[model samples]
Target: MEKVVRHRGWQWLVGVWCMLAGHMACAQARTELLHRAQENLTRVIVHDIFSPPVASRIYLYANAAAYETLVLGDSRYVSLHNQANMFPKIDQPAAASHINYELAALYAFLRTGGKLVFSEPMLKDSSEHILAGVGEVDEVIYQNSLRLGEMVSDSILAWSSRDNYAATRKKRRYAYSKEKGKWTPTPPGYIDAVEPYWSQIRPVALDSAAQFKPVPPPAFNTDAASDFMKEVKEVYDVTRKLSKEEILIASFWDCNPFYLNTQGHLNFATKKLSPGGHWMSIAGQATQRAGKSWIETSKVYLLTSIALFDGFISCWDEKYRSQMIRPETVINAYMDEKWRPLLQTPPFPEYTSGHSVISTAAALVLERELGEGFVFDDRTEMPYGLPMRRFASFTAAAEEAAISRLYGGIHYRSAIVNGQKQGRGIGNQVIQKIRLNAGIGK
Candidate 1:
């Protein structure tokens, strides 16, 4: 009788140990899965050469799909199916049975990411590897996860079809302006403006693209003593005296998709992350540091993506509307005919900086989710051969990115300063208006 009792006690201990080990494995898998998803997104963005606005749209829908699907599995979280704009009616998972939340979230993330990115084969292979790592579970649980992921992906894709992405893709040509205060292509290529019709694309959170336009850029003045010329001179003067640290900051946040590298006769293009992509990487880093669960990480990506999408819309609306000239253009025309900006100016209208608007919008959402004054090492640019940058807070990083444009001589101080304000407003709107439930009961 004593031997039998001891044997039973040993069996109980073994079972408990297995359960704990399984839980730990799932936690590790969740972080690995999210990290892989983000990497695939970067790959697709670089290979496909998606401009910033199009990249933001892809991130928004894909992250939202993943978030809505994952939240369904966690009783501690609620779905955003009906809460967001133009959300499709998706089939809900079975509420009666015990579902494996980890597998469900992983499968959903894979499905959503596969749809949004161009590197389909790589993403699919990564998903299969993740599923294998999940090891053996009940066949019903596995099948259910697969089915639910497919449903969520289809729903999100259907809704995205109506967002005018296809229509905008057809608009390849834009009118060129010779007006002194208006934008014209700059340096290298000096090609037609990129995504001139981007403002017409549907915004996820904003009422319209023009919902919050920044104040008009100060009137174009050629007079060297005028405020407008002073703004141009500031950019010129700053470029002349850029410190080594300032140059590093400028290069760190360049985020120019069309950067060209030419040495002698060997010219090749360097593919880098867009502004929105950089913020997405930051979201992934913050979530990993916080030890967030799949549901929590999904929320971070979803909100940050939406902020980028809407922030770009608002910024571009002001850009094309105001038709403001870049500092490089103004400086060359009036100050020094031979002068060029320290950094290559991107081919787009300037008013509110795109980097400023999106970075601050994403920073605010991240701060809200990951505590105020949270510090982290941003290694996102390291893979691009840039050194890691440490930030006291997400806001600090955003502010620095805003100022880097000034130091780079690509934007005036007014555009950088006002762009931060516009971004903060957009971020506040996202935090207050878009409701996500912490618990599933609601």
Candidate 2:
């Protein structure tokens, strides 16, 4: 009787050990899967110089697909297929077979990311290698998960086809405006304006691009004493007197993918994140810092991406509508001929700053998702060889990002201030419309 009792006790200990090991493995998988998504996104950003609006659209669709697929395995989150204006139909899994959701998420990212990015072979091979690591222990479950991921990707791509992204690509040419106070390509390449038709793209949350138009910027005035000229003077004078800290702030938020290198004639350009990519990295960092699970992290990315997508649309509507001049153009025309902005002015109309709008919009969603007063060290820009700056909260970082445009001498005060207000409106709409739940949607 004593021998039999000891044998049963040993079996119980072995079962508990297996359970603990399985739990640990699951946690590690979640962490790795999230990190993998962030890395691939950075890859696409660095692949070429995508304009801010185009980059936002890419981020939105990829993340939306990943979020939709991930939430299918867990009911704690909701899908945005029908909630967002025109997302396509995604079929639910046919069977209740056990799925490793982490594997499914990585697979979903692979499918959507491959379709959106230029680095298709690299992304596809990366996914296959990752899936291989899951082992052949459960081949049937693995195959089903991959199929589900592909199904989600196919639906997302179908929806993306109607967003006017490809149509805009055929008409990429934009006419230059030589009129005073109008945008002119500045410094560096001096290429024609980027994405002049961006506002025409379909918005994820906004009813239309003009749904949340910001007030027009102050009218251009050539007189030295006029308010418009005064604002231009402010940009010129502030740039002239920029402190070291101010310079760092401007450099930190530059987000110009093809900023001039100036190191050599052969290598005169360096690639970095666009404004949208910068905010996406911030969202990923915030989600990780909050110790969120993969399911919860997907929500953060989805919300932030959608906010940025619509924010860009609203910002671009005001940008082209106002056709207001950039500080670069104003300062050179009316203030000082020799003056150059502390940063390179991107080739586009400047009313309603893009950086300010997207950054604040992303901050709003992040704050709502992660709560206020969250502090974290930002290493997202570190890979670009910039120093990591710590922030007290998401708003603090966004406010700095908004003001950085001023310090960079790229935008006037009105554009920066008004952009934040416009962004907040869009962010609120995303929150009000999207629903979250722990049950499957109809």
Candidate 3:
């Protein structure tokens, strides 16, 4: 009887020890996973600044998965599967693979909730999903996994989500009409008062779709002008040459964020431009105190604040309507292959430079709001890890930069000239509309 009792006690002790070890391993895995996810998410956000919409959506979904993981502890897998159903349109094989990994991880975390050991299959699936998404080969995966493993082994490290980095408050005082129940727009003569300065500024233009003589389409291969094709080829070559997924990821990442409509206004306002770059610093300061908090940092507010979006949209609509070819395409084949641009050509039809129209319109709006004397420092930085450059007035910055593309071999001088003129017209129209709508100083 005594021997049997002792044996039973020993068995119970072994069982308890195994359970405790499993719990510790599970906790370590969760912490490590969270940290890995957060690092990727940060990179995604930074890269999104220049990216288009489709890629940005994928990153958004990844972020959402991480958030769910954090909230539900080990139940993130089930949560993601549920969420995947919400985005019914994202049924691509690649996306489905990612969903499966999340599901597996969630299951492992839940099954061993608080246990120390994670299922090997779950870890493998998670790692595979990440690798597949970025197109990294197995070797790169091993390196990332090793780094994560080292971090996991350390008990003190913890992971947290990145905070919202966008500006989200209004700085100006605004009132809505009580009787008519509509927000009052800014006054009309407000913009006309600023028009004289525009006449002093140089105009920018684009390739004439129809000439004064009405010539036929220039005889040339249009495919040579395709920026998309160039990008695809460049990406393929980079992947082959470097064999580093990080570089490829960085390239794609750089182009994704700008595509999204979210928080651009806040980003633009809060973003420090080059000194003497553009706009009145006083206007940036003045609007820092007006209206609803959320509206203040909105893209609409910033663009409208300077009254540039109106002219920008008008010019854009007309430019695209004409659909002119860029100089990069024309000059390359007709001119020389050795002729390279100083600045990369923006991907779009070139009629009027979008930057010129928008920048000039903003300058006009800023001059009106803050008067001609208001000056601010420019602090805009270059994309990627490039060095920062400074400027003087927004108009000076706009004009020089617009012209720089010509010097850079990307745009024709004509396009720059016509763009500037079209932008001015658009700015004047926007000012008139705002004044008429606002019932302000007419």
Candidate 4:
């Protein structure tokens, strides 16, 4: 009888140990829950073929929603509302409430992102799968966490409604100008200019959309000896004479989500990440490489997304303002009518390259958060079929992204150089203005 009693006691201990171990494993995987949610958002953005500028807006709101949720009930983190404008005060968890903050973060992210994009079903399916896994473990915690998530998501969605996005949607299409310097549609799709009133949308960090506008692009000049013409000639010559490495560099960074391919009588679009999406991938890689905690990871994403958002606003404000002509239009009309750029020219005005401004802004934020001299191999394009590329540092990667525009035959040299300056300026602004609470994030 004593031996049987001892055997029963050992069995109970083993059962309890297994249960505790399982809970721990789920807890650890929750960090990855954030990454999975991020990946889902990235995929949806790509599939939906959002223009680069619009994609930046989507990233900003989603991650901002996530970070705000993360800060709730955790004194280690701080809400952006405390640092920047446009945020409403979010109520903390009730004193007796039981909530899993990370799950709440994912919920807010998916909910906000779904509201912004057209393909809600795609994102909704993924969200359900993630939540179902939590449900199996502990129905009570899952219910509580989701309730917290919904509350946080509701506040953010409400804030987003007032950002003038819908008002911009009702605005007229971009009207073209016959003047030589002004922008017009490109070949293939010739889609209307994307988000022309994006400047009018409320900024998350900037005082206004024009806060860090670049200097006006060089005046329209075609004389061979003119500075403006020289930059145009440089783009023409470099793209036509691109070496294998240069071609690779251009192709690697060709994050044009609007790229259209044509066959005999048939044209199809090849959807890919925008330049800002690629930077988001890099931010994720850096966090994983350094083994950052879930909270730390959310902070990195939130700041980087903010930089991308403001950079686009600053870049686009100049793009439409200068209304500079694209290289393809110039080279084909004057230099070679039969010539086609190595990459498709996006449908928008050219001046301050969007790639340069956003890349530099994102890199600067990452550099400050990840520290200088941080190294990582970018596999962001791998899913799009490009091999991974290594970078010695964040700024180095940003420089390459800026120059890729010239090699891709999309922007003039001045656009690339000045865009870098513009982006760096925006980055400095974001890094200075938006900071972690108590300086816990490093």
Candidate 5:
């Protein structure tokens, strides 16, 4: 009887040990939870019609909140408080708290994102849906995890509040100058320039907004043989006789947030993912392919968002400084009175393509994270009805993105080329600046 009792007791102890081991693995295995929360944030950003620049801001803060939570809760990861210098020191939970870092990271992302968007109730509904799907958990661990999440998100929110976004809102709107070759609102919607003062916002890693400034745009001359006119003619000619392949490529890369469709006086607005949102989705997809743990995935999003956050600041500085005109506006006025490009031009200056700049920056950072020559199928456009496109490498995808701006007729070749140069510099700078996940980016 004593031997039989000892055998049963040993079995019970082994069972409990297995359950504990599984619980720890579950913490790392449920990275999908974080991705789902990020997807929800993207949905809200689309619903809100956030411009690309503003969408980039929302992405960085939400992702930073999640990333910072992991750094605080997980000892495997190093804290970026002093490394990045953007995040301030945050209070942590008690040392022995049985916290679930995965749940906490999701909550941090949701809470920070909810504060940035207008529709809190929508985010609230998604939050409940996400939380309901989590696996069974002890009530004590659940409460402790959520408390830590709030503490981390609150610290991120405090740091973001002083980036000068509010002060720019109080400033007057951008006024279009009557000078020749200056940018103005484009047709189809004729919306005013989006985020003209975005350069004034604080940068995350860059020393200043103009840290990666490109050379001045081609001289604006109307003479038929002039460099500017030659560039202008190329756009008019290429768009006029676009191939089926060109159309598909242009449509695939058109990450316009809000586009107006008009038909005989019945006009409505259509919403799509912003440029930054597309890259964020790609990172999520790639990480899943690599089977990265939650800690690795968190760092990827944080670093990619940092590149995009600073890329926009650098690009916008040159944009408003040069104030070069868009292709559609110039082609219609000088080349052909009724000439419209194959794609609708976005409402912004054309000195540096935002798509080109941010895309290259994102791709460079992704290469550093995922590595060079990493091939993957890009399904980011599938949600918008486009087919999957395969890439041999991150650089290949980035080059395609830069050329897409020209094919879309939204950018001069100079803008796309220079934007790539600028983006490359920003990407290298970001990789050099961030310290966590060492021996990886280097």
Candidate 6:
């Protein structure tokens, strides 16, 4: 009886040991997976920010979706650092950190299957952390570090790489650009002549522009704008209604980008590269040189699309919140109905320009990723089928195009300015919280 009892005890002990070992192995796997997901999310964020506008949008959305899935698993804490590290390389470290924290907390709540709420103090702490960590690095290097983190994470976790996704996306963008044909250029003399007139009215322009400044909820009235002001208004209105003053208190908080009808006469005449123009070809060449695979290259385009759409929504919300009258509304009331804007007005409010914000924010993010001094020849086509004009910097091109909306009489100058600021804010916020497993930030 004693021998039988000892045998039973030994078997039970062995079984317990095996179960413990299996549990440990599973825990390790979960940790590694979480870490890898966090890393990939970082990379995706960096890549989306640095890539072309279209490409960035696509990747941003996909990254967000993927992150959402990962956050639901055992490795969810990996995204905790995202808020601390998002836009860690930008000049506005404090703002970036704040955004990162806000997003991280939101993601945490989501992962916990809890309700979402924005936390201001946490975001501020995150900004401080990032600033302290990257105090010495140059802006470019700092930005690259964020990207490197992503690359490392993806590689270790076996996620898609930027090069591979970029290649396929580039092909599609290139095909679209080809179909759009060439854009006509604005003459040097015309630009020069316009500059003097623009200078003379600059003060009045700035003053008038102040009226369209981004207002928080309760102050902004979406009902005042036309029904056509759907997309642009949605972003502004939603943000104002949702975001608290604490959320808007950051130094770089005002740097959001806006959109407007730049497709008018000036845009056509400038012969600048349009968003839909030969982006695919440019991306393709870049991808091939890097030796990226198809899955990786395709992600570039996917992210870009996502960003663009998100920008549109965000900007629209802003407009709705402010409910400020559009240039068309004011101008038409005073001027002739025949005095139409150079570009067809988008079906949204004119307070904040969605395109201006998205494009500028995208440019800022891309410039950081691609390198500040790096210049690329832009042979891409423009809207209205004109020849492409080259630019030294993506931001410069986007800025010019954004301002052109004012000159073309499609948007109030103030609207474009505010839009750009807002767009940058949104982009930074979104970029910081991207984790491979966590997905898009709240």
Choose the strongest candidate by TM-score.
5
lDDT of 5: 0.85
Model 6 misplaced stretches (Cα beyond 4 Å): 1-213, 216-306, 382-384, 435-442
Whole-model lDDT values for every prediction: 0.79, 0.79, 0.33, 0.82, 0.85, 0.36
Model 3 agreement with the true structure over 137-254: per-residue lDDT tens digits? 2443334333333222221111111111111112223222243211122111111111111111111111121111111222223364655334323323333344333332223212
The TM-score of candidate 1 is: 0.90
Candidate 4 Cα errors over 4 Å, as ranges? 1-28, 132-137, 439-442
**Count of backbone collisions within predicted model 4:** 0
Question: What does candidate 5 score on TM?
Answer: 0.93
List, residue by residue over 122-200, the lDDT tens digit for candidate 2: 6666665444444333666766777777788888888889998788889847776666676667765676777888888
| lDDT top scorer | 5
Over 4 Å off, model 5: 1-28, 438-442
Q: In candidate 5, which residue pairs get closer than 3 Å at backbone N, Cα or C atoms, i.e. clash?
A: none
TM-score of each: 0.90, 0.91, 0.36, 0.92, 0.93, 0.39
Residue 29 C-alpha lDDT in model 6: 25
Model 3 gets an lDDT of: 0.33
Cα miss at 274, model 4 (Å)? 0.9
Better of 1 and 6 by TM-score: 1
Worst 10 residues of 3 by lDDT: 187-196
Q: Arrange candidates, best TM-score first.
A: 5, 4, 2, 1, 6, 3
- Segments of candidate 1 deviating more than 4 angstroms: 1-25, 95-99, 263-267, 438-442
Model with the higher TM-score, candidate 2 or 4:
4
